[model samples]
Target: MKGDLSTLVFTGCETSGCEMSRSRQYDIKRFCFQTWYYDATEGRCSQFWFGGCGGNENKFATQEMCETICVEPPGRGRCYLPRVDGPLRCDQLQPRYYYDYTKKHCVAFWWRGCLGNANNFNSFEECSVFCKDVGPFDEPTTTTVPPPAPQNIQQFAPTPEAQQIDIVSAEQPQQQPQ
Candidate 1:
């Protein structure tokens, strides 16, 4: 994370309530997509944060990018459009949840589309371009409901000694070199 780069395509707002750039990294075809950075803050995706699609706002890659080619897209799926235009403008889609380590938060977003290429390339930067093209939309399956955390709902209840545990657990535990 020392040299981790923050991306912005247009004004470069450094926004985009997203992370998992390093976690959801995947292969869409010949390219590699890596979620290298997660947004520690949110308001709007910077120019690079909100990538542009070949089509309207309906089409967007995941907020998290894998590479330049590979990306999460709004594929042909049965999506339920909400009465009110929800956060993801696509329609009514189920939200997917991921534990973000960099942000130390459980992030949520709707799956809107598929990876552009489908082939996994080498560098994590390869698939990042896909993120540049896709923006937030009506994820065919998604919602923005972060699982509830422990708060003092009872006024009389005694406060616990600890606040909460860090939810960001690395998939592969790091091993120390001998």
Candidate 2:
């Protein structure tokens, strides 16, 4: 039996008269089939070829796809939100536009054929399409409020005729003939 252990080390298993150990007794269906097994060491699902003999208990037939059973992906466990490497460029052969607050309108500008910020748009149409709808510059409305009415306020209109009357009244000052 001691010699059998040595042979098992090289051959992985004894071809004859070797019952599966108690740990591997669960693999009752060890047959020639490609099955998926969770490779805990690599944290992924791996293809395992089951021999028509005794084997380990890690065999799984479609019960463990890599995504569902393996470890979490690069970031979150399930959902993957890609990183924003950089801002969207403007020199993409297609004309682009940007909204200028000073101008109060979408203005056309040529990108320097280099990397640019996301403040730019791919086209004038694209810029105008969303500039009005999604920002502080939507369609404008005008409403006029009349000025307040006069409140006991005296406003004098000194015309030339009023000045002449005042001069005559000054010259013919009140004279009592008594």
Candidate 3:
């Protein structure tokens, strides 16, 4: 599979694996890891949980890899286009970011999850990076918020101090009488 993938990548062939659905193989051990996959229909890379076995080549180690392999490089004019929320028929509402040519910065918006133009990006950083050179502004005017973490990935637990504060707050001393 590795050899075939290398060949396909080097030859610039359309890899059928990009069209495969995210596969979380069922295993007794159940070793799951966060991974990225190319969503051919949406024309973007998205995060998915991989069971660490029996998945297709669509699984990429990083979003950049998936985009490099599956997505076409954006054309010169793509950055100047207005934000598109995609068609109304698709109900999946995904939080996405796009470069606002007028605003001259990246802004977050809800994408309808299909057929949006290349202006749409998975994160503010991505949109900014791609459109920075193309836009009228020399640099983004607004402060950037870090992109949301992947849904399937586990977030860090609260700090020990925070937990202690919560415990103390929960155990308010009982007052005897007024």
Cα lDDT of all candidates, in order? 0.26, 0.37, 0.61
Off by over 4 Å in 2: 1-94, 134-178
Model 2, 1-178: lDDT tens per residue? 5534233322221121111221233344644566665443233345655654655534445643323322222211111111111222321222345555434445555443344333356655665555564335532233212123222222234567666322111132468899
Off by over 4 Å in 1: 1-66, 69-89, 109-178
**Candidates' RMSD to native:** 19.1, 34.3, 13.7
Lowest-scoring 10 consecutive residues by lDDT in candidate 2? Answer: 76-85
Predicted candidate 3 versus true structure: per-residue lDDT over 1-178, tens digit per residue: 5545444443332334655777667353567778898665565678987778787777888887666555543353455444556544555567888776667778877776677556678987788787788647545555555344323222234566765322112133579997
Every model's TM-score: 0.18, 0.24, 0.38
Q: 95, model 3: CA deviation in Å?
A: 0.8
Q: Which scores greater on TM-score, model 1 or model 2?
A: 2
Residue 62 in model 3: lDDT: 86
Count of clashes, each model: 53, 0, 0
Candidate 1 lDDT at 54 equals: 27
Tens-digit lDDT track of model 1 for 1-178: 3422232221111122232222232333345422233222221222222222121221124444322211221321001111111222332233344322233222443332222122222222332332323343222233336334222211122236455433342144579999
Residue 62's lDDT in candidate 1: 43
- The better-scoring model by lDDT among 1 and 3 is 3
